[model samples]
Target: MATLTILKYPDARLRQKSKPVEVFDETLHTFLDDMYETMMDSNGVGLAAIQVGNPLQVLVINIPREDNEQYKEDMLEIINPVFLKQEGEIEWDEGCLSVPNFYESIKRFDEVTIAYNDRYGNEKVLQAQGFLAVAIQHEIDHLNGILFVDKLPILRRKKFEKELKRIQKEQSQ
Candidate 1:
């Protein structure tokens, strides 16, 4: 498994909407493994295919649990997720690999039921709550070309725009 480069915030490619994954062959399986590797290497809980320059509706999430020993055991290889139900409200200090060095209190559903496919194209339904729910929603947004900062309040969004500009400048230097 390779660690793919994550697209940074404000990168035009990050705004590209992902297309649904149509194949579940070995190639897809390998790419999923690479995505998982990349997410772990970046210390991110979730990563979408589009973040790695692939515009496919695929994402991998590994919610860390107590003891942190259950890392890979809880990996969710979701493809083409469709939210079936979302309830309650939760505000999480969400961060993204694309949006480095920033954390925002973003409101999201506390619970969610989503229908998605596994790495092998096996349809599955997951009912997630709390942090798990938030991570799933965050990755889904990436698939739709929506960044967490875009969901922030206007003031915060403006602040992030300035920060993003600074980061871009540093990258170009």
Candidate 2:
């Protein structure tokens, strides 16, 4: 599996809604493997296809252990996920592969019942709470053309935009 380039924030492609996975085959599995490698290489716990410039409703996640290490066996490759139910609320300090170094406190469901397809097109349902739920919601947002940064308040959003401009300018120089 090879690592893929993660598209950063403000990339127009990231704002594009992803299309549902129409076919599940070796090709899809290969892309999932590469997505897993890319996530691990970047120290990201989860990634969506849109983050890598692919407009597919695909995502991979590996919830870290107590030691904060992720195991391959624990990685989940999910396709065309939908939230069946969500309840309660929790604010998490969230970060994203696409958003780079910026992190923000965002409120999301504390529990979620989600339905998704596996790489082989097997439908699965999962009831998750806490961090796992947050991770799933975050990735799903990417699939829906929403960014964690978009959840920020107006003042914070303005601040982030200013900071992003500064960072891009530095990188260009």
Candidate 3:
């Protein structure tokens, strides 16, 4: 599997909403494999297809187990995932691969239940809490053209925008 380029924030394409995956074929399988590799290579816990320039509702997540600090081989490959339920609330510092080097405390559901189609076209439901729940919600937001920064307070978002501009300018120089 090949690693795909992750689109950084401020890229207009990232603002586009993703369409659902319609076919569960070989191409879809290959794409998911590549996405998984890309996410792992970038040391990201979760990634959305739109982050890699594919406007499809696909996401992969591999939250390392706390006890062993090792990620399970079975990474979550979700297609057309939809939130079935959310309950409780927790505030945690969150980061995104697209918005590199930025973290902000955000409130999110403490528990979430999501329904999704697997790589093999089988429908599945997952219940997640803590970090996993937060990660899933973050990735799903990407599918809807939403970024973690978008959830930030207006003043904080403006501050981040100024910082992002400074970083981009420095890189260009």
Off by over 4 Å in 1: 170-173
Worst 10 residues of 3 by lDDT: 65-74
Candidate 1 per-residue lDDT over residues 48-153, each given as its tens digit:
9999999999999999888764378789999999999999999999999998999999999999999999988899999999999999999999999999999999
lDDT (C-alpha, whole model) for all candidates: 0.94, 0.95, 0.92
What are the TM-scores, per candidate, against the unseen true structure? 0.95, 0.98, 0.96
Model 2: pairs clashing at backbone N, Cα or C within 3 Å = none
Model 3, range 62-166, lDDT digits (tens) per residue?
A: 988867454658589989999999999999899999999999999999999999999988999999999989999999999999999999999999999999999
In the predicted model 3, the residue pairs found to clash are: none
Clashing residue pairs, backbone N/CA/C < 3 A, model 1 = none
For candidate 2, lDDT tens digit of each residue in 1-173?
88999998889999999999989999999999999999999999999999999999999999999998899999989899999999999999999988889999999999999999999999999999999999999999999999999999999999999999999999999
Q: Residue 161 lDDT in model 1?
A: 91
Order the candidates by lDDT, highest first — what do you get?
2, 1, 3
